[model samples]
Target: MKEMILMTPGPTMVPEEVKKVAGAQPLHHRTEEFYELFSNLNKNLKEIFKTKNEVITLTSSGTGGMEAVIANLFSTGDKVLVASIGYFGERFYDIAKAYGLDAELQDFGWGNAVDPNVLEDKLRNGNYKALLVTHNETSTGVTNNVKEIAKIADRYGVAVIVDAVSSLGGIPLEMDEWGIDAVITCSQKCLMSPPGLSFVALSERAWKMAETSNLPKYYFNLKKAREGVLKPNPDTPATPAVSTIMAVAKATNMLLEFGLDNVYKRQATYGKRVREYVKSLGLELLPEEDIASDLITAIKVPEKYKASEIINHMKEKHGVLITGGQGPLKGKIIRIGHMGYVTEEMLTKTLEALKDAIKE
Candidate 1:
């Protein structure tokens, strides 16, 4: 089998050591062995999230965790402000609507970041229930100033929920310190694990809301998950993804071993290379430099040709799979993912192939 380097925003390359660890003897989910695994994962993820809150493990994707927040926190006819700067941000609105909540969206152009001032203005006097936003808009490669948004939401007595699926591990998110109530992350993106698990870090305020929330939630019930985690048995009510949990356990250990600070630095270093390489191709950067997310870099297409050609050539010819922009900016931008178990060498190699592809 030919090994191709994955440069897509999600499902980034997994380390061989992690693969080896995951392939090791599987453990039963009901035993003390699984308890130790869950406990370690919970503790380590708290460190990564920079939170003291309980980290709930969900057996679905990031969207499942997002739905969990909506189902458990919003009541019927409750109003929520969804920040829409990219595809992920728009999903919050969709989630709100699916749960029968009143959703107000603050729309921005793709490849743009959500302005903190806009959030403050919308949250100031509105009878809103919660503020939902994406920490990093993976589709456009823009990182929103969630800390500032959290501050605004805090001032208005509104809970702040973040879709941090793509940004959690690669970027720095101090959930508790930033006043984020519920933050959702996925296993495949920056977590360096296969896609099977979703993680949520919830503040005490969010937990309190879950207790009184009138949404009909059973499988994704937040209170039940918390109860399970606190129980003496340390088992969730549902049968957890045992094999994937094993993979996450090893990956989290590797992340801690590398040190969070060092891990972020690696992303930043590779991101810089990506920016320089893309600029060398006479293309522009998507997000503003200071506010760009280190997880992935979205490069603007040159005015000469269409971005579709580039995506096709890079994938079919070079076996270098990259992602086109999502939502409104599709075919106008292509993103290169530098997040998770990646090095400068990997980025340089991708850039070299991209250079040839564009030139041809």
Candidate 2:
């Protein structure tokens, strides 16, 4: 098989140390040894999120963590104002309705940020139980205006749940400073590790609601996770992702060693480089320049060509890998992730391959 370089937004090129750690042997969840791992995991997760709150680690991917947040913090008929900007945002609404929540979706066009004025107006109505939104809408490579949304949610006394799945470490996230009640993320994406580990940074307010929200919950319950994660022994309600946790420890430590400021700067700079390169290629960008995500850049495919054709050419001919758009934007956009192990060389090579592939 041809060795490939993964440039997709998710399951990004994992670091060598991360892959090494992921190969470590598993352990029993109830043991003190495991608890020790869990303790460190929670501590560093807090550091990465730039929060004082404890983080709940789930055995599943980011979706499981999102679902747990919905189940434990919201109940049937509870009014929720959700911001829909991309594929993941739609899933938030889907979860809300599936669990019987009164979901009022406020939509922004794909690749566009939600209007803060509109959110403020909606919150002024003062009728929501919670305000749920994604910090970085992964599907569209657009980062939402989370701080503004948090301010709006606070004015209404509605609990705020943010899906930081792609923004946590790659971006500077001040959960408490922004007044975010619940911010959930995944190990994949900008964390620069493999999937199967989903984390939630919780405010005291979020936990209070989780304790008495009367929502049915089990394995992924935040309160239960808090108990296990806080103890000296690290364990989950289900079997923990031992390898993933080990990989996370390395990944987080690497982030700190590199210094978060540097990491975030690199993310921003790398993305800007790609965006500039894409534009020079005569292609349009999807998200507004100021609102684009540092984790990935979504470039509009030309009308004369198919996005998949270019993607296949890059993969088969140039050994480069990127992603096509999801949902309505499919076949019209190509996503290039500059996060994780991505280097300037990779972007340059990928761009060269893209140029070659698009040559008529």
Clash counts for the predictions, in order = 0, 4
Candidate 1, run of 10 with poorest lDDT: 340-349
Clashes in model 1: which pairs?
A: none
Candidate 2: worst 10 consecutive residues by lDDT? Answer: 228-237
Tens-digit lDDT string for candidate 1 (1-360): 677789988788888877786778877878998998888888888898899877889999999999999998878888999988888888889989988999998987677888777778888878798989998888888888888888888898999999999988787888988889999998999889888889888899888888778989999987889888887667778998877788888898889898888888888888777887788788899888987778888988877878888878887777778888777788788888888878666776789889988789
Top lDDT model: 1
TM-score for each candidate, following the candidate numbering: 0.96, 0.96
Q: What is the lDDT of residue 170 in candidate 2?
A: 88
lDDT of 2 by residue, 1-360 (tens): 976888887888888888888887766667777677667767788888878878888878888989989998876788998988999899999998989999998998898898998888898895898888988876788998888888888888988899988888888789989999888899988788899888888888887777777778878677877776665455676778787887887888888888889988988888888889888888999998999988888989989999999999999998999999999999989988777777777878888988898884
Error of 2 at 53 (Å): 1.5
